[model samples]
Target: MKFIKTVSLAIVGTALAIGGAAAQGKTVKIATEGAYAPWNFTGAGGKLEGFEIDLANDLCARMKIKCEMVAQDWDGIIPALNAKKYDAIMAGMSITDERKKVIDFSVSYANSPNGFLVAKSSPLAKMPGTGEAFSLNSQKEAAEKAIDAVKPVLKGKTIGVQGSTIHAAFADKYFKGTADVREYKTTEQHDLDLAAGRIDAVLADSTAIIGTLEKPEFKDYVMVGPSITGGMLGNGVGVGVRKGDVELKKGFDEAIRAAVADGTITKLSKKWFKIDIAPRS
Candidate 1:
């Protein structure tokens, strides 16, 4: 009787595991911002070409599964993910403790700090802290020093950033009340405004600014000030999955780690952003 009972328990465990696997294998839909350039923005021809698109494709290849990517507004991406509009989100979203409460992450695949973008000829291009890196969490003293140094040059200047992004968070943390912060729905729209002299400077992701700098219309725009991460900027970008999908989350985590290990992510990052930012270490 003891042996029979043990065998039954083992069989039940196996059945439960198989059921979990089957549930995870049921198609996954990935969502992206679809407006942030060099991340997941739509091109002039309405084609998606950017870092997130490339990395998402690479991860799907690693998983050896058929997946669909949907373009949605950034503000609604997370809520929609929770609402089942998509199984996961691949936008350039930082994995933070607050965000963790509502969803899970599939490992961070890429990271670039919040950086400043300005017209090449603008005085803001000469702002202090140029070509430097600082972390608000690791080295608060130095990060504040950098902020204090840049404050003078940015004083009373209008800064443009996308609405509801980490950039906005950073502006609130460091530049709020000091600089006039304007928010835009799309990076392209702000890029146009910056080109038209509507805003003195723009704060956003480094890779996104690279996309803006590549455009003929923004031929003279440049990155200035310090590259910042950690603290309010939060952790690196990752695939956000719904809560309670631990099986699906584990599959994606394994696939993402495998892709990074095989250099698939590095290759795609370079292909799209001209940089190599695979899983860090």
Candidate 2:
């Protein structure tokens, strides 16, 4: 349904917003995967933390809005968003053409790229060709050449990505025919699978993987691949809002700009990712 029945929304609230703090009459339930670590993920005690969490709270304070963060599984996130289960989405969601048809996007809050990681013991551990950046949209030949180079090694290899995510789209577009793509419900699941040898590799946000690689459990994994953006990746992660509600969208855009200008984003990025991804440029 386009707009959720009140009873349905209530049930969803309890199920997805367990940790959500109750405030006054006005509350904006924000939807997230709650599993895209470093973007937005649950901490050890199962509390929300990451770059998006900091940004969300900062934006809410900037807009003087009463907000609560809710964890929505990746696949049903848009459905939940359209159903009014949440007022906004900030779960490292990219702004793409398909999504724009159903929901509107505020200005992009952050722009990071997709990358591949393999067990350090794997042969393809060192990416064929890499530098600062590359793109499939604008540099088709080079990107395809890179893909071709890795095809032999990656063939039959199981690569895990979050389901219904931009990472999945990227894999399908470039590597699906050449390799087996395994979809997971969350990035953390893929991370676990890669560690357990269930999957040969993982393709996800570099920002997200940095968190996984930090743990002692993932010590043997290495980020080995060209980082990618543009084209299939869309315009980086942004806020997803229902059509209209211009005031809330504008408020978020202004708040993001303010956060960027004042260096809050860099600070948060450094804290979470241990590197500054504030301005992807």
Candidate 3:
């Protein structure tokens, strides 16, 4: 009888320990820029909404972890993550080699191409290659040709891009001396400057520019030039994590893969972006 009691107590203790470990494993805080629309943004009453928010919740549930979403500035996000301000970043952050040196990233969840937004009346709108997709990795010649085609039109024109983004990097690399590149703290600010004629063109993600162009005030604005991807744009959008947080990165990677396999990412993409931007297998 005593042996039976001892064995039951041992089982209970093991169960308790497992339960405690599971509880301790969860409870992570994630950061987003809240200014990047459709991917993430502040909605009515300042509530965070959009694709990343929905995707974050879904990924957290699949990981069986409790997550808290916090809004952080775009430029400061990585530094703050390294400072331990958040456990992960889901604000449409791309997986870039430059960023990989400081932090780690999970498998890409989505890949939205970048492009230029210009007023329909602008001469730059006449630049060639309307709907062509250019991959710097696989289609370097084509991407370079497209860049060369637009360089003449953009000469002496001021292009606005969000600072610290791939778009900014692209602008610096290709248009620095050819055109004046203006950097803004947020996409919204650049959109405003573009709308006000303060900047001749804006370089940003196609989906984000679509969000702006859909607004009644931006009726004259249209996305132009080749849709760009790969190369300096990075591998795609992924969850950014601290370099040493391998376990957390693993959890997010597993959750992202499961979501991709189950079509949840496609469903969410269509809902927010009106198109499927899920990373190709």
Judged by lDDT, which candidate is best?
Answer: 3
Per-candidate total of colliding backbone pairs = 0, 0, 0
> Where is the poorest 10-residue window by lDDT in model 3?
1-10
lDDT of 3: 0.84
Candidate 3 C-alpha lDDT tens digits along 160-198: 999999999999999999999999999999999998999
- The 10-residue segment of model 1 with minimum total lDDT is 1-10
Q: Candidate 1's error at 241, in angstroms?
A: 0.8
C-alpha RMSD of candidate 2:
6.3
C-alpha lDDT score of every prediction, in listed order: 0.77, 0.76, 0.84
Candidate 3's displacement at residue 46, Å, is 1.2
Best by TM-score: 3
118-234, model 2: which lDDT tens digit per residue? 888888686676444677678878766776777778888899998898889888987887889999987878888898889999998888878888889988888867777777788
Where model 3 places Cα greater than 4 Å from the true spot, the runs are: 1-26
Per-prediction TM-score, please?
Answer: 0.89, 0.87, 0.91
